[model samples]
Target: MVFQCQRDSWARQFATRVVSCRAAELRPEGGGEPVRGFQPDDRGLIGDVPVLRVTRRGPEAVHFVQAALEPGAEVLLSLDWERRFDHMQQHSGQHLITAIAEQMFGFKTTSWELGRQRSVIELDTPSMTAEQVEALERSVNEKIRERVPVMVRELAADDPEIETVRSRGLPDDHAGPVRVVDIEGIDSNMCCGTHVSNLSDLQVIKLLGTEKGKKNKINLVFLAGNRVLKSVEQSHSTEKALTSLLKNGPGEHVEAVKRLQSSVKLLQKNNLNLLRDIAVLIARDFKSKPVQSQLFVLHRKEGDSEFMNIIANEIGTETRRALVILEQDPSLCPQETLLFLTVGDEKEAGLFLLAGPVEAVENLGPRVAELLGGKGAGKRGRFQGKATKMSRRGEVQALLQEFVSHGSPEA
Candidate 1:
């Protein structure tokens, strides 16, 4: 058969604009040297990788090359093989998964998506639950344990054995032996993407999660082999910490965790009580102050959402117009990253200004954040995010003084 030029896909995929690179001599197979000087037909191919034809296709120079040995013929090699393995694994695994999903759940692997970072195999079954996905994962991995060789065979068009083929379909322009990959009695398909020679090559296939589609197209996300190994290592480390927290040996880990759960609930209630008392004391202090304008202050690391809300209400309660900047506190650490701020109308805009540094002033949001060693953005007179560290009481009181000393902030 004569060689035909297939359309190179490299052009469309990358919008690259590369400058010209000169070619040196084509070295024959035998010599180990760089061939010293340039040869006329000595294209970029011969030195390390020998050539058949050099075709300049768009940005990259695609070499129509063959191995230096017998049957040394044309094949494609590209430097950018980044993440192709994931696609191959997904497509290949789709076949195995589809085959097994049919047997176990009576559902077929009807469609697939070869994502750039992950792969998906859609199942025909509708309304798949989390439990079903877990079961599916277990069953597929069990099949892979069989270590059945994935045999790839090319047969003539007239081959009668084609009837016995587990092929899902035939390829285009069927002229030569049909390439069929068979996993013993399990699955068979006509595909172009490379696959592992045996099921065992897919040591561990983890189903990351799933999505829903029409007619119940259950799409699955998966990680294979090395990816699974990394995931497992992470899980093991977490469990090890959990065991230490439980204060029980691994055998009693479950009970220890339950005990911890009970303790956390008790702590939550006690914490709430403490915040209530703190709110009352702070509110009384505000009542004692002779008001010039409404005061709305934000303190980092000082407390939780409840405390912030309580203080905000206490400060604004007696104000004739009423306004405050009560920031929410974390149920745990008040200064922990959270959506913790309040905004009132411009009529009470002075209350907004009270956020001075802590929000003591309006336009100085960035400076307040900077003083706290943090980063953030704001517009429409409202802003919020995390600081590198929460402001202490003395630090917050100092900022309050600055706001009192200077009236309205500069825009």
Candidate 2:
């Protein structure tokens, strides 16, 4: 059936009589079970109610109204002009690009999507070159400038002229005659989507480039009419922002950003070296103490796994007599805190190594981790993982001290 939307794409308002009204079960917001007869309003006249959507149900054009209505009520349907116009521009633009691409490069369009922001057409080619894209855009816009007429023809399903037009076949539930959209001197295809009456209505088309698709296909992206202008405005705004931040012209933005990234990398390498040196010194200071404590705890505002490992290596076999816990500042990461706990006297230590009394180290390591709202695992004497409540660090410290003095964290 040729609906009003397809017959006259330019129509903004439609007046129709409701043949039937029934409660429908619609999917609820955020998606769960469908809600039956979810009426947001009471029964009303045509002008008081609004049509939410109009779709084809079998051979009938169904209107999903926002309010309850009798079987024979008349309603005035108002089209969202802006949205409808956008669809028209993009749908017609797709036809132009699809036709020109096949004509120039023999890249037939397999399918296309009229996306909310932009439109994409999948061509039956493995790839598309920049030169081909440029040529396609030029040819499409040229036809638009020439103001080519777009006509629609409805013929019987067995019409002889149907063989001359491009078609992907009709749907199983399709009824009535076949509708073909013809672009004069360009191409003709069987379609049911709304389209502009003239190529000029597309205003202009900008080929945004291509991306790889399934089965060795290429999807070409594009924008038409007001979308092109909007895209240009957004791109210019971004360029201006980049120019201001980089203190360079738009042409130099790439080089400026590359140099900045190189400088950041160098600074990070130097910072890591300095952190390693600091870790060594901290380990040496604890080892050199006249009377060594049983527990050694150190917290740094900024350090990663590498920094913690350096300190553990410097401690060496000292872990046999002391339990060391290294932690990043809890306040720095209020959500989750990183921790490294090692209790071993081995010369070469792995992460979270435990070399103390089998029972003491095993019990203390995991228990302390639990106190900080986290979980950890260790074989000899090492425990490491993230904690959600590092604010309970004091309790974990006390537990460690008790374990060192009494041979058990619980005691």
Candidate 3:
């Protein structure tokens, strides 16, 4: 049987054959026990291949290969070399950093995770100093400059070399030889994940910063190789945009933003004082009119419902008259129209009295709501609702005017 390996700039594809086929279970990370009622199909292969997809079980499971093949059927596999290479760079850089940190300062690493844009290693310490991070970065880069060879060795579990290597405990199911990755004169670790073949293959590792983690662990965030380049490009683009928008040098962007914010606050304060004066004028004009009917209808084009409510309340307190306020619609359905109602009345005692009783306010609320295709509620003689059908504003006003002509709730 012939095996074909196809190479490209982004990925590598290959063809292999299935050795065996069976069912398998997938295990969850950090789940101490296996999950029940979950199983997936698997196929066995004679050659090595990288995994890209996963089948999850309920909560915990085991990993298995998935392929559609008989004993000797050909299988095509596609591997993303760009992603793999980036992972290798990051994983290799992490090994060097972890080893150097432990050897020089005796700081033990508890755990580590390789993220999409960055990676983090949790140090088993309460905190890390700035000087320690700088020194660790310097040492890791020194190893990269030396172009140290990375060697892989597989030895039996009882071999003498097994006793000398560093490991984070073997799984209970491990039955075969243990694979050890040795970085020349730097570190040796037992890892299942992939890595670069040489120290210089990492390119470089830049320590971004650190943060406090669970159980007093210090998480060191860093970027490796291509991720570092991408981060720098993004930051440069953002700085250029900020400089252009602020019309200032990169260094002065923060000061310019602060000045703009201060100017905005001053203008906002002035506009609020102007709105209060306008409310007073609107109230005086309504009170000057001699219409003493039980209901007053008015429509406004400017200001929101809240602003209009302020002017309506001012009219109520100044003239102590019942009022209905709404937005005048210049268009038809789908434009928002606001409706508000308020009445002047004294609080009546005894349990039989109606709450917030206003003849037009109570009777007109639901009718106007139907015309507006919405609902309204009120307390202390005031009601408000919003309508999407702007064309019904005239119908709402005509109903209120009809109720006002009869002069009572009974009418």
Candidate 4:
């Protein structure tokens, strides 16, 4: 059975008598457990009460209401005209594009979607060239300009004329006559969606371009009617914002951004070289000490992993009794601190370069990490990981001191 929406797409206000009213659970389109009394704010009104949603149950139009009503109550059902018109424009535009593509280029449309902001039609082709898209858009708008009539014909289920029109197939529960929408001298297809009466009602169509689809198909995206105008306005606003920020015209925005990127890359390269030099100096100062402490700790607010590794490699070559811990200051990263730990000793620094006591490192590394609210792993006397609580660095330092004094983490 054809619903009122399908029969008359232009109808904004519908007057009808309620057949029945009952309380029931309704599941949202985005599948979930059934909800009771789901009142959506954007729904239309049934007389004084809001219509939560409307769905098709078998051949009947089921209206989900927020409140109970008498079985024979007379109600005025009003449609959100703006939204309905948008849907009509997109739906009709899809039909036009599908017909033209199939007629002109043999690119048959497999399916289509009338999206909230824009619409898409899936063509059974591996890819679509920019030239083809341009041609299709031109032909579609030409038809709209000509103001071609869109006619709807209801045919008997067993009618021989049904075989002449394009159709996917009838639903398993579908009954009664078949509805075919025809674009004059263009194409005819079986459809149940609401659409405009004339091609001119589509206003204009803007082909946004194409996207790769599954199973060797191309999804062509487009904006119809008011959507095309809105898209142009949005693009112009974005261009103006970019022009102000880049201090360049819209045509030069891309070039200006490229130049800025190049400058940033050069500055980053210079910064890394300076950081390396600083790492070398820091290591040299520690090694120059006549009598070095058994443990060396350093924290730098701006140091990265590369800088930390450089310092570790430099100081690691000569110190046999020292254990070094480097921390990337956690102030900038309130939730986590990057830590690097290395034990250096000339005796153990052989082919594998085993830096210090393996037992001491294995025992202290994990314990230190735990106290700082994190986990770590290491081998050959080197450990590193991220810690959540850098404020407990003092506790980690104390643990390191104990390990150094007793030559074992347990002490």
Candidate 5:
């Protein structure tokens, strides 16, 4: 999960900036407890340049490992295969994407940050417009489909030609030939990160987002393989829903969807007119009733929040003594049920307790706020919620009924 950075201010000299301590390089190995069934050679690579296996905290991140270089660096490791897979996806993805970007845009990948969830590579040039990104994405996908071999070859650190390899990561030693990854005729870059067995194995490469940075550094973040598949499935499901809603035949799905979107604007206007008329009628009905004693509850199963507000205001303000309850979330109860209560200016205390087992109120309300939590108080028979305890709602209601009948001022 950790990598060497040339941009840091600590030391410009690569070797001076870095010291190799094998035990220190890998975080999992830093602790005192010995690993079970781990051989000495299982750390990262075949030699001194370390490759500590990443440990993922979520589906995407490697955590708890310190990435700085140390003298005689040892590696810490996690045994999770997903961590290794993430590295493989990102590293392999980098090779394909960067190579395509280079060929298409005349840009070089200057650096990259291998993050836990997604990786970002910096380009040497910036201002590549949106169209270029889209085209590059398509080309990378094509390259992956080609399923070209990804080979890792190690050379003596002393080889002169090692300087010719395009690499994101270069070790300080000129003493040995270098380690280079050759992607057939496409790319040859020096890197220590894990990679997929073949280009096809990397599957999909999705450019999630990107950011422009200083000195023309474009930070491109993307996902590969399974992540891309899941995203595509989710988008397809949404599209199908949209298509069905538009009432368009499958053959004309796109046209249907566009038509529906346009129709919805007009439909919304008509629906609003209907709702406003309904609100007026309800207001008139409540104003005509006995103001001192009216209880009205209105519910809309389709989750129209405005409808709830409309009915509540009509009944409560018109009758003055009306208690209008409106809810979209019916808990576990039937969708039609909503609760309301009303009382006159006599201030006869009444409680609308939805006190019951949580199961009873599961679909019942936001009323749990009042029933269990003792959340509210009022002058007349109008008290509401901080729903707390679920038990004894029925008993509490019965007791309050008696208090109201007896003309108690509060309950």
Candidate 6:
């Protein structure tokens, strides 16, 4: 977990020699055009002291490299050790992983990134197999264990060694020395990010997974050093929870879950058959007893709507019996309930309305639905609707009772 940081700069008070200049005095470097109102690289404070660090060379007039310091002004310069170390470990691990993939499987690393928690390398290949990932994990960790030296050198653009290195490309305004990193005998590539001095400093490299990326490429997700340990801890906790819930060992949880799902399905089927039978019995008893005008059953609970519909259908076929089934609103609204109405008279032969008059039942669904604060639709004397206001159930029931008794819903 050793960290090596090269890019981080600390603001220290440097000797200042102020000089006046004009716009025309600016000189662009590497033959680039001059820009106006430029900014310096770094800024910090120490008591009454203000310091600026020059990070890059630019036009002489617009960019000032130094700031005047009052006599006896104290200065402070510090580095974020944890941040520096994390960046080094991830960046160095990336170069090693990229090199191993390219050398072993011919899967070229098109690009890579050093994220906050994890890093990813985009490969030129469209997809990767489980076996390929395993192979990569094995080869990369092997190099980490070997602890190869990482050498950085600034090479001239025309140098012979430059031709042997793998590089993304130089910047468009290139004019300086090309800095290249060499992972001993494994890889040598041009990079600007900070990195560890040796493969052993990375501790380990773990390839978590891969996903299909844009333009038919593959992205390899990975974690290095302490991050790998954190992921392992979190995954272990989740497995323990799943094992306890399933009442089985981690290896047998999948089969245990499958068995539970199958049992649930069987129970649901049996419950539905029993409800249908109960509906038949209720309808038959009502036919024999012949209650006043209509046989309306209201249950205030979840799962009663299906039973209501079945019972209504059974009651619809009996002589002189019209059905109005309502279930209480699960949402706790008294005026809003579910209604299932079917006015069928199968015993009436050709008329089909003698058992429960069709004219009386035809328009009842719409009015009942309106009282229930919703709309409904039906044909051939069967309909279902929602009542937005379950409190209005009395009005709906009264209307249905009138229709069943006097052969007119309005009556």
Among all candidates shown, the one with the greatest TM-score? 2
Cα-based TM-score, every candidate? 0.53, 0.77, 0.61, 0.75, 0.47, 0.52
Please list the Cα RMSD from the true structure of every candidate, rounded to 1 decimal place. 13.0, 8.3, 11.3, 8.8, 13.4, 14.0
lDDT (10s digit) by residue, model 2, range 303-357? 6666766776676546433332224343332111112343322222222322234
lDDT of 3: 0.63
* Candidate closer to the true structure by lDDT (higher is better), 1 or 5: 5
What's the residue-level lDDT of 201 in candidate 3? 84
User: What digit string (tens of lDDT, one per residue) describes model 1 on residues 209-302?
Assistant: 7777766577777777656776788878988897777666678888877887899999988877986897778667756765433334444333
Per-residue lDDT over 228-338 for candidate 6, one digit per residue giving the tens place of the 0 to 100 score = 887889889988998889888989978988999999999888877886687678656655662323435453332344566665555555432222222233343112112
Which 10-residue span in candidate 3 carries the lowest summed lDDT?
345-354
Colliding residue pairs in candidate 3: 25-62, 26-61, 26-62, 27-61, 27-62
Kindly report which residue stretches of model 1 are placed more than 4 angstroms away from their true locations once superposed: 1-92, 103-105, 113-120, 128-147, 154-179, 203-215, 220-238, 289-300, 321-407
Ranking according to lDDT, highest score first = 4, 2, 3, 6, 5, 1
What is the lDDT, from 0 to 100, of the residue 283 in candidate 1? Answer: 64
Listed per model in order, the count of residue pairs whose N, CA or C atoms clash below 3 Å is: 13, 6, 5, 1, 45, 9
Residue-level error in angstroms, candidate 3, position 360: 13
For model 1 the TM-score comes to 0.53
121 Cα displacement, candidate 3 (Å): 1.5
- Candidate 6 worst ten-residue window by lDDT: 346-355
Off by over 4 Å in 4: 17-43, 47-54, 63-72, 279-304, 311-411
On residues 292-398, what C-alpha lDDT tens digit does candidate 3 reach at each position?
Answer: 33444554443444555666666565433222122343232121112343222112110011112365456656666666655667655566655555455556556
Over 1-411, each residue of candidate 5 has an lDDT whose tens digit, in order, gives: 123211121221233222222333332445765432212222333133334453432222222222334435444432345655666777778888888888888888877776766678888876667788889888988888888888877766667766777865553433333557778889887765567668888878988767887775778778887767767888789778866775654568877767777899899988877877776686567557433331243323232435444555554453332212223333422212122322111122222322212233343333324444445533232334433343435544444344334533133
Cα-based lDDT at residue 192, candidate 5: 55
